[model samples]
Target: MTTDSSDLSQVDEEAKLDLTQQIRDAILGGEFAPHQRLIEADISARFDATRAAVRTALLNLTGEGLVERLPNRGARVRAISVDEAVEIVEVRIGLESLCARKAAVNITDADIEELRGVRAQIEAAVASGHLVEYARLNQEMDRRIRDIGGHETATRLLERLRAQSARHQFRLAFHPGRASQSAPEHIAIIDAVLARDPDAAEAATRAHLEGIVDVLRHLD
Candidate 1:
């Protein structure tokens, strides 16, 4: 029995995509530090993929702005500077505020309950000094708002921007007193959406992200 060439091609593409996502997750999860070199052989061995596959995966991540390729230096996780992080958050402020408005108009009873649960968890995490958990739940809340808003284009753009800005965000998450400051902002967003107040939701979302830009500007 002969395997079809098209079938083999599809399998290869799937494997490459899987490998790319694994490396992307590692970078986003902080397993790979910003600007750290990604050696092809080491990555190949670590991920149990071929050098060629690792190379392709790195290229894909580079396109996604999660990795960078240098002349004669291979690739490394891209480092987003404070200025760039602020710019990214500025862009997010517009997009996320739009999402908040749309989500306020589009949210249902079930979505409201779901977001309330996440908000409660975030409050609990903050009250207990679990900053990491609070950070993660904050992301969860953003994702839920996007889903509820149902803006595919905005969601796609935000996903890429979020990945590119992950390291800076991770730093902000652990900054002194950041969680305490941000928890109320996040809760305000949720409250506005649950209240179905589109104007207030948009205002709350903009305030939340604008605060991040302020902090990014002041980051040492």
Candidate 2:
């Protein structure tokens, strides 16, 4: 039964979403590194799809600013400049502050529990020095907060910025002692959210974002 379902999905390309997702997964999985040029032919060959499909996928990634399309150079993974990094950090602060504030009013007990589960896992990952797990859990926490906040516009804006900001953030965040510093900030934000204090949640979340900014200053 599982084989049949998987077989049926093989030819499903009506939406083009699967193709886009595969490309994104490839990028996120570290198959492609920052500033690595994407050869359309190679990608098409890998996916067993047409050049058109590959081009479409590239265009979508470009639109999201995750891939840069240069006139002569073609597409490469986007790289963030220090200036861009600062801007992204600023935008993240505002978006997450909004998320924390809105979440105070709308968060359910189940949502709170889900956040706690994510937080616990993040803490464990930090303790074990598991950078990959830590990054994933960090993203999950951000996503949960955005979802619970009920601020669609702010969430969408943050999502777009994050797509481009990831390389810089990943570099800035996983520094030797940085994960340990970050874990408690997550706890503080969650504490404020659990208390249903919008002001406290907003402040706590902003403080957390600023903490990252401070660490980023020390990056090589």
Clash totals in order: 0, 0
Q: What 10-residue stretch in candidate 2 is worst by lDDT?
A: 6-15
Task: Evaluate model 1: give its lDDT.
Answer: 0.93
lDDT of 1 at 220: 91
Clashing pairs in 1: none
TM-score for candidate 2, residues paired by index: 0.87
Tens digit per residue, CA lDDT, model 1, 1-220: 9999999999999999999999999998889988899999999999999988898999999989999999999999888889998999999998999999999999999998999999899999999998888888988999999999999999999999998998899899999988889999999999999999999999999998999999999999
Candidate 2 per-residue lDDT over residues 5-34, each given as its tens digit: 665556555536678878887876678987
How far does residue 152 in candidate 2 sit from its true spot (Å)?
Answer: 1.3
- Give the root-mean-square deviation of each candidate in angstroms: 1.6, 4.2
List the candidate 2 regions with Cα displacement exceeding 4 Å: 1-15
Each prediction's whole-model lDDT (CA)? 0.93, 0.83
Lowest-scoring 10 consecutive residues by lDDT in candidate 1?
130-139
